[model samples]
Target: MKTGIAHLPLHGGKAPSWLFQRMKRLAREITIAVVSEYGPQEMLRRLSDPFWFQAFGCVLGFDWHSSGVTTTTCGALKEGMKGLEVELGLFIAGGKGGTSRKTPSEIIRAGGHLSCDPEKLVYASRMSAKVDSSAVQDGYQLYHHAFIFTKSGDWAVVQQGMNDASKYARRYHWLGSRVANFVVEPHQAICCDSRGDTLNMVAVASEEARQSAVILSQLKPGVLVGEIKKIQHLHLPSRHHVDIRDIHPDRLYKIFVKTYEQAPENFESLLGMEGVGPKTIRALALISEIVYGKSPSFHDPVRYSFAHGGKDGHPYPVDREVYDRTIEIFRNALRQAKVGNNEKVDA
Candidate 1:
């Protein structure tokens, strides 16, 4: 699978309903074809591929270069999979905004029906979200998460985060089979147009810093808070992006108490502790840099790419006649092949 971080412009509004309906049908048909020929795990592999996923969004008739492609295409797939998930042995949960938060419950519900371990899947879903948001702070706040899994427990994730300052979005892909370690360079590769200031604690080079962070967090709350207060008085490099609010002693003490009690064995465990967000991680990383002389990677992990335009007509408006004809051809082929859902797809 081709893997890389992707950058795209933010398109306003939603996909037109007429286009979305056809997208739903065509999306479902293509999914059925993939699952029948390659099985659900291979389908997961494909979804975990950024190139294939972007092409999929294009084929679904969404704006290929916009961030909407991720959310809208995922929405199309999830909407299309509605009735066939059980039969197809594939389940897609979570979506943009509020739907993203419901991923755990949805995973449990699917697992209850399928008999595979739900907790593992839930952990995968939650950790993937947490890693991209906190472990790798690349100026994007994640607002969309789509988790796709098979009945056999194979899984993949396609989540997007947006940088409001730049009006650009970054996409992250995860194939459970590809990720052996969540904290150390989980992505197969990191590519972007430009490297901005980012706190990439997940980078292998940050191993020492991560260890120091864990050790520092285990310090008594009072002692840790005292150290943080001292850092506030020192002048950190501007690129470090430290904020007074991030290391406020009162709040830091509370968070320190939790980590101190937990005594996390590793950085991954410390990261998963409750209330450990970007701010807390950032402060710890800065402290590690100042005191331990081990700074986290500040390289942004994103790549730039261009694709076909959208319904709004950047390059050209979507050709409805051709799009419809393509769907019809696939539906007819599936129908002739006697697939159970061919008739529904043809509709």
Candidate 2:
């Protein structure tokens, strides 16, 4: 599946309670309509599409361009889907901040209910987070993660990360059906506002770098620190743009110690370990490039815009009253159509 990307300026504040409640209702109605017509799996596929997800948030009456769209829309979906899992054959787990950490347990519970493999679902949840946070060093630190899945094990992930310095947020989308390699091109789309140099270990071009990093992981801590120092010395004079802040010797020492203790057999295992974050990942990639001449991918993976015109006149203003009325109309139509009643279409 092709990945979609959009740039969204970070906007603060919670979505108003009145608006959020309406959003939940509208989202539920829309989900019911979609599932009734296409099936649960199809709805999951659409949710995994960044463009469709952005549009879905717009139709539910959110600020089309605000970063709140990602959190609020997913929140609405989670609330709307409650108590309807059996009927819909789908589950949404995880949310912003602490809620995101609960995804594994939530997935396990949902999998048990659905008679699916809990272990596999849990692994997917963790790996998706790991790939985005460690493998793709795009400056944004992930804070929100939502995993959506169906009874048949088809899953999708909608997660957002924030770059505090830039005041921008990037959203990552994943579809299980499209993920051939979790470390390379795993995202169906990455939505962000700005594109710059990023250390993307998951890029197809970074295969050799990834391999080199794994090899580096097995080395002694002192050896890794020496390699990092050499890298720092070489780049310090010539490259002003390269940020060596992440190349701290102390941090590298700690990461190397952890690596030695864990003895990760592969790059994926190294990344999956605790304390192995973007800084460590970037350090290894740089070392790989410096020593082995295996350059990592620096290309930003963001594809295109997923946000609609904003309500506060960003690209254009959306009329709040009109937007609410539109939702009401759609919700009423879906109810009248008996969309979720499983009635005969011909009748």
Candidate 3:
């Protein structure tokens, strides 16, 4: 495949199954090639073609093509975060967001530098920034991710925003003094579980926010719950493949009970409880799909490519055929890499 596929049009619809399958195969091959050649960070830096990654998003459901910089999905997370009443404590590293080349211990140390509270610090540190949402504004990147460390040392991810945030609500005032001008209710909070479970928080203030997420799934094929059976479907195509979204409460509760081999009583206990979060949800999502047939959306919601040129010199959708060819070229390049032949073949 040539690089011309990048020029194809991109509509918010599904491609033909045969084409979709070929795209999937090519995406995996290209991803492996990139990983073998440049490693994670270098690949991210070198790949200037957004169309290829965007097509990968269509296949993977998670947008592995770009960082979570100013996304509407992040906006959805923000709306969800605003609805909660807790002190929001976030944990992240600068290199985080879409790569996991760093070790767990390394990331934890970086988290320690950011905070004094061991709970918040540890929670923030253990959580990877792969799928964490962020926005670059005024020459700064605001990472919208958190670690909900429970009293038990468990954690979950929280994506923040208001349901229909107005200027006063979305706007955070930087008070001259140590304290800010506005007081946040419930104080976005995070806790952790000791059992190697990642429980993070994505705050949602209203049923509307939850419903909106469900709506996103309904409207877009790759936006909702991801597929089971395929491990790659867990997140968008990336180096580490660890971008897990904040799951719904009802869904979270269901997975926890089933996966741990817990009884119905234990399942009910997890629900109506606090701090059972994203890591837990991830565990559940994995278990449900692997053990059961249910699946979730893993398609990248950042549908349009960053490199997509608009008709009026703005960012808009590009040609479909061009996009496919572009993705194919990337995949072909990966095939030439010297990684594990079997692994490459599997991908």
Candidate 4:
């Protein structure tokens, strides 16, 4: 069902009791609708989208925080399942030094006890294949980060999200409940967890929405998957895509050396490396497709951009008056939440 005013004040942080009760009722209705309309796998498939998952996170609210989202993410794996009743979070450390510690290992530690093989718990950074790429940050720097984690735990982490704020991240909440309601949830399938770190070859959703993803993939190249059925020959878009195919090592090494020749400053260090980043990879992929018909998958890995038409598809420019009305509706609904005026105010 289309979300209503109740979905608001649910996500901005804390939820008031009255709102919580209302959400609980909504969640029940949603649960019944989902079970009646779709099978378990279909439900799981829908949750895979970061946007849908983030919406569920908003509904689940702070109660989700107590579960050590890290653990519930992968813990079910040790028991031969997908994930536990879990919540996904997306937070940004702003400020000059809005710092975040907890390396991959530390994050796993924070995720509570693991039942998997203890020896397999310790993981090393997976930056084996090294190549240099230029990133446009404050200053240009030759970046080289090869981080990886052991596959024997209840949580994972990644470096970025759909937005800079943590409040809008994604996870696989089953409706509004943390419960997975499955026999085996598939642990090895997740790409990133709570650690801001990732594992090797885990299939990640290359994009969200419909139109932009279709355009981006069409403009580039890749086997279409998930909701883009028009392209045919597609899959559910998961973590394994990263593992199956690899950039030809020989071609990559040569490209790196040549890059130094063309743009000497950027390519000097990346020569003969295994993992040449997305930019260099894109450059090589472009040349390969143009010159040799060997095109890498043209999926847009970024999550924030849209795929289909923007909100409601009005075809005309949005009216500012309507926009304010929408915001005011939510603001008022937030006011009606369960927490006191103060907590809700901060929320």
TM-score for all predictions? 0.92, 0.87, 0.25, 0.27
Query: Candidate 4: where is the Cα deviation over 4 Å?
Result: 1-56, 60-101, 107-275, 299-347
Q: Model 4, residue 227: what's the lDDT?
A: 19
Once fitted onto the true fold, the runs of candidate 3 whose alpha carbons sit more than 4 angstroms away are 1-30, 40-163, 167-316, 338-347
Backbone collisions counted per model: 4, 7, 73, 34
Ranking by TM-score: 1, 2, 4, 3
Error of 2 at 197 (Å): 1.9
lDDT of 3 by residue, 218-254 (tens): 2222222233224434553342122344434345444
Question: 19-92, model 2: which lDDT tens digit per residue?
Answer: 77777877887787788778888887888888888888877767776689899999999998889887888889
- Which candidate tops lDDT? 1
Taken over the whole model, the C-alpha lDDT of each candidate is 0.83, 0.78, 0.30, 0.27
Weakest 10 consecutive residues of candidate 1 by summed lDDT: 301-310
TM-score of 3: 0.25
TM-score of 1: 0.92
lDDT of 4: 0.27
What is candidate 2's local distance difference test score?
A: 0.78
Q: How many clashes does the backbone of model 3 have?
A: 73
- The weakest ten consecutive residues by lDDT in model 3 span 167-176
Of the pair 2 and 3, which is ahead by lDDT?
Answer: 2
